[model samples]
Target: MSYILEILPSLLEGAQLTLKIFLWTVVGSIPLGLIVGLGLTSHFVPLKAILKFYVWLMRGTPLLLQLIFVFYGLPLIGSGALTLQRYDAALFAFILNYTAYFAEIFRGGLQSIDHGQYESAKVLRLSYLQTVRKVITPQVLKIVLPSIGNEVINLVKDSSLVYVIGLGDLLRAGNVATSRDVTLVPLILVGVIYLLMTAVLTFILRKLEQHYSYWK
Candidate 1:
């Protein structure tokens, strides 16, 4: 117990890193995901094909492999233009992986919308962008908020993968503390921290669902 107390500050520091990664990953990925989702639904055959291929490649492969490739391979292939520090590499990897997954979720949400919505928006004389922004997106968000919430919760846990690239996130912090003291208590503490984070995320997402429910 005393050991746990002693390590509390270090664990909190690690939690900060974990939170930072989670926040940035969501910020960077959400817009990219929306764009990719739009591209996947594009009318242009070539554009659709390209976006489909991108989504497939990202989703089909393991994120760990993708992280290694981005961090290690890019430096080998395009060292000058794609130079990345460890933290940057982890951020890039998480963004790419999460963006692809979120894009699919967004695509699924968009597809769930009825075709009649588009026609109705057109009847209202809204441009394509306006139609999407004002009409389709709101409905889609209502339909997919639950799923997006799950993904967001999962992302909080997944941020631990940043440790693979040497980003000192929560799991890595616990590992470091455990190694020094030769005990597993720190790991348990780390798990509790992660659970707490996920709980908070779930609560926020639930609130978001309720907030958006008015649109339905």
Candidate 2:
């Protein structure tokens, strides 16, 4: 317990990093995922194929590998256009990986809508974009929210993975503290931090679910 207390401030700092990574990843991924999801279902076969390929590549590879590739391999290639520092590379990898998963979820949600709704919107003189925005998006959100919330919760934990790339997230802080004391107390403390984060996220997501449910 003393060891845990000793490392409290350090762990708190790391927790902030974890939160930053999680929040940024979610923020960047969601809208990008929506775009990818829409593109995957586009009428243009070439666009759909390209989006599908992107999703496949991101999903198919391990995230760690992607991180390494982005940070190391890309720089090795002449594509200096996307030079990324360690933390930046981790953030990029996290965003890309989560975006692919979210895209699939969004695609599923969009498809879950009845084809008749689109037809009805067209019959009522709604433009295609208007039908998607006004009619389809609302229904898709209802269906996808639970799943998206689950992924967001998962992201809170997965942010720790950034530590592998030298981004000092909560778990990394625990590792550093434990190394100094040769005690497992820091790890346990970090676990508590994670539990707190997950709990708070769960509560918020539940509230969001209820808020959206009213519209349904």
| Top lDDT prediction, candidate number | 2
Best by TM-score: 1
The sequence of per-residue lDDT tens digits that candidate 2 reaches over residues 17-134 is 9998999999999998888888877789999988888899998998878988888888879578767898889889999999999999999988889999999999999999899899
- Residue 12 lDDT in candidate 2: 98
* Residue-level lDDT tens digits of model 1 in 6-39: 9999899989988988899999998888888878
* lDDT values, one for every candidate: 0.86, 0.89
Each model's number of backbone clashes?
0, 0
Per-prediction TM-score to the true structure, in the order listed: 0.95, 0.94
lDDT of 1 at 64: 84
Q: Candidate 1 — number of clashing residue pairs?
A: 0
> Candidate 1: what lDDT?
0.86
What shift in Å separates residue 183 of candidate 2 from its native position after superposition?
Answer: 0.7
lDDT, candidate 1, residue 9? 90
